[model samples]
Target: MYPILFSFGSIHFYSYGLMIAIGILVAYYLAEKKIKANGIDPKRLEWLVFSILAGGFAGSKILYWITRIPDIGTDPTIFTNLGDGWVVYGGIIGGLVAGWFYCQNHGMNFWKTFDMVIPEVALAQGFGRIGCFLAGCCYGVETHAWYAVVFPEESLAPAGISLFPSQLVMSAYDFGLYFFLEWFSKKKKFNGEVGAAYLIAYSFGRFVIEFFRGDMIRGVVNGLSTSQYIAIATFIAGIAIIVIGRKRFSQSNK
Candidate 1:
């Protein structure tokens, strides 16, 4: 994998960073279209994006630190490597909390805005996984499958070893999820229904994907990865939100 896409003089262009930037821009473009369609001001969506970036970055870093506590105990300098080690689940949680607060402050319908925003989030995540693949991070376990990939020297995964293309797999899944959410949103009857569906679908998908992950950077506790636990909680929360929303809507129609 080409981590350093190119370098001009002292400036280095990283494939991972580039892909993430492109993803954010594309997601913002799509979100702006949805915002205008929903009769909401684009300025508010901009503010929400700001909140997501700030909070998501912090949350992802914190979770990463937590996962590396074991290593940090041995090498205190591990804490200083702030350029890497982020957990996507943490970012999602942080972004959700921050977005909810932004909506409350601006008098926007949290669930409605969330429903519109999540599809874009999934789309962006799909692109981000492409970055992961390019950087050779978030790799999959070794396998003899015909579809397995082999990383070159200087790559993140074990060099010269055949491994599952887990990053690409997740990226494809995220893209499919974005389309599904976008289509499902039109048929949703409640404000939170679309967002809830995203939670359930994504959490379940991640839970399954974790089984193929080769990296141990994502901490494990009690025989399950930290993400697995988070996924279970979020999945249940999603189901609860859907059930409550449906019941509330039903009651309102009576």
Candidate 2:
């Protein structure tokens, strides 16, 4: 894994950080295209991206700090150490909350914007998983599968051994989701369908992927990871959205 990108005399870029920036940029580009197609103001999309970054970063750090306490201080000399802070689920929650608020204030169609963003989220997740692959974190159990990836000696792990490359697995699933959402959006009979499908697809993906994660994360009360809980909740929310949207459509047709 190429965890360390490169170093100047005193500066270095990590693969994880660089990949996340790229993902955000890609999301912005998609948003621009979507805004023009949907007849929304593209400027509002820029504000949405800004809010996503600010809130996602803050929430990711907060969850990471809470979990890494005692070993890593709230204030540390080196922030975002390779194994230190970052929880992907936290970033999702934060991004959703912040994006909703931004859309509301700007008088954008919140559900419609979410529909616009479903494909972008999949694309971002696809690339972000690549970052995890390069960073050697969020890896999985050892495997002899043809797809297995072994890290270099300097890498750290819960067991400090070469293991399954879960990050790549997730990236593959996300890319598939990107295609699915994109195609489904084109065929959607009404608004909110794309966004609903995203919640359903991503939730199912996370539910299965958690099994391969070698590391133990903060689980909800019943020993399910935070992501599993979120997945279940998101799935329910997706169902609710579909039901409500369909009901409204039927009523309007009356």
Q: Best by lDDT, which number?
A: 1
On the 0 to 100 scale, the lDDT of residue 236 in model 2 is 92
Tell me the RMSD of model 1 versus the true structure: 1.1
Give the lowest summed-lDDT range of ten residues in model 1: 75-84
Report the number of the highest-TM-score candidate: 1
Over the stretch 110-189, how does candidate 1's per-residue lDDT look in tens digits?
99889998999999999999999988999999999999999988677789999999999999999999999999998999
lDDT of 1 at 94: 86
- In candidate 2, which residue pairs get closer than 3 Å at backbone N, Cα or C atoms, i.e. clash? 141-164
Which residues of candidate 2, in runs, are more than 4 Å off?
Answer: 66-84, 156-160, 217-223
Question: What is every candidate's alpha-carbon RMSD to the true fold?
Answer: 1.1, 2.8
Give TM per candidate.
0.97, 0.88
